[model samples]
Structure formats: structure tokens, C-alpha cells
Target: MDELSVKCLLHANDQVILVPSACGLQEMVNKMNDFVKKKSVKVYVGKTKVMVFERGESTTECDLIIENEKVEQVKEFIYLCSRLQIIANMAEISKKRMNADNKVNGA
Candidate 1:
């Protein structure tokens, strides 16, 4: 989670657990709200976003809400001046590393 950008990351191994449905996500936010209230910290719900990085027919339009305020769903959003994308596969990560090394080696 990047506080300055007001972004959060929720990751899970798809094989081990199920990604929550829209209703389930709402329940999570409600729980989070309760926790925040206990700590006396206010959550800036306006900046909240929901990003899902699955390689399938997943819903990009997540109707997640906090305090009845709608949170946005994004694809390929830039954060901290860098495009943040999910490295879904091990091969992709290896390919990216190879490319970076080649560039540094002036190839």
C-alpha cells in the first residue's frame, strides 16, 4: 500500500484461495472501517481503488464501496511514476529481468 498515492494491494494465490465477490469485498471494507474506528483513524475512502490481476475473465468493474462512496476499478494505472502491473507468470518476470540486464549491458 502506498499512502502518498492512496493505493492498496490485495494479493492472493488463486490456487489456494478465492478472490472475494463484490459483496464479499464490501464486507471486507466494512470490517476495515470498524478497525479504523477503533484506532481513531479516518480512512479517506475517496481515494480507494480495487485492482485485480488475474489472467482470465475477471470483472474489471468492481462495485466496492466504503461509507456508501464508490471506489474505482482500474487497469494499468501508474503509481509512483511507474506503471504497476502484475507479474502473473514466472516466465514474464524472468523475461523482464533479462531485458533489464541486457539494457544495462548495452546490448
Candidate 2:
């Protein structure tokens, strides 16, 4: 739909595509086809990754394709090194706490 909005974030050689809905994503992909051809930029299909973030029990999966290349789906891909480190530290703390609790309970 033309009314739908899509956002593209460019950082270095990477690009982040965001859409409000699945239809918006389709619209963005359609526009990107024209954009790729017009810009004459080589499509790096192998390097492309897609991450779909949704809430609750819905099991619907969104597939992102650009220039006829299907992008790989990732469970988690952190853009910020600091954020990733924080997640890692949190996991370590949780593990240590669980171990201490188990020892105390003699489990």
C-alpha cells in the first residue's frame, strides 16, 4: 500500500529495513527492486539477513526478498557491541545465581 511507511537506516555498508506491517514490507521490497536497478548497486544476497519481531502466540514468519534473493533469517543479531556485551553479562550473572542457589539447596 502506498499509504504505508517504511524506514531504511544506512550505516557503513549495512542497511536496516523496518516496516510497520507485513504489507508494508512487501511494498518496500517492491520499491527496492527499482532502487537497486536505478542505483546499479550489486545485491549482496548472501550477506543479507532478516529479523522479524512480533509478540505473542502468532507463529507467522516474514520472508524478505530483494532482487530475487531470499535473505537468511536470524534469531538474534545485535547491531551494537555494547548491547551484546550487556546481554552476555546478564546471562553470566543469571547462570552464577542459579548455580549458587542449586548448591545451597543441595541439588
Error of 1 at 57 (Å): 6.3
Query: What TM-score does model 1 achieve against the real structure?
Result: 0.52
* Alpha-carbon local distance difference test for all models: 0.61, 0.68
TM-score of each model, paired residue for residue: 0.52, 0.63
Off by over 4 Å in 2: 80-107
RMSD of each: 9.1, 6.8
**Ten contiguous residues minimizing lDDT sum, candidate 1:** 12-21
In candidate 1, what are the lDDT values of residues 5-84, reduced to their tens digit?
Answer: 22244443111112433436566567667887899876676655567776754456777777778877766556445676
Which 10-residue window in model 2 sums to the lowest lDDT?
80-89
| Candidate 2 RMSD to the correct structure | 6.8
lDDT tens readout by residue for model 2, 1-107: 37877788787767777777777775677677677778887768787767665654335577778776777776556664422212235566799789999999995
Error of 2 at 22 (Å): 1.2
Residue pairs with colliding backbones in model 1 are none
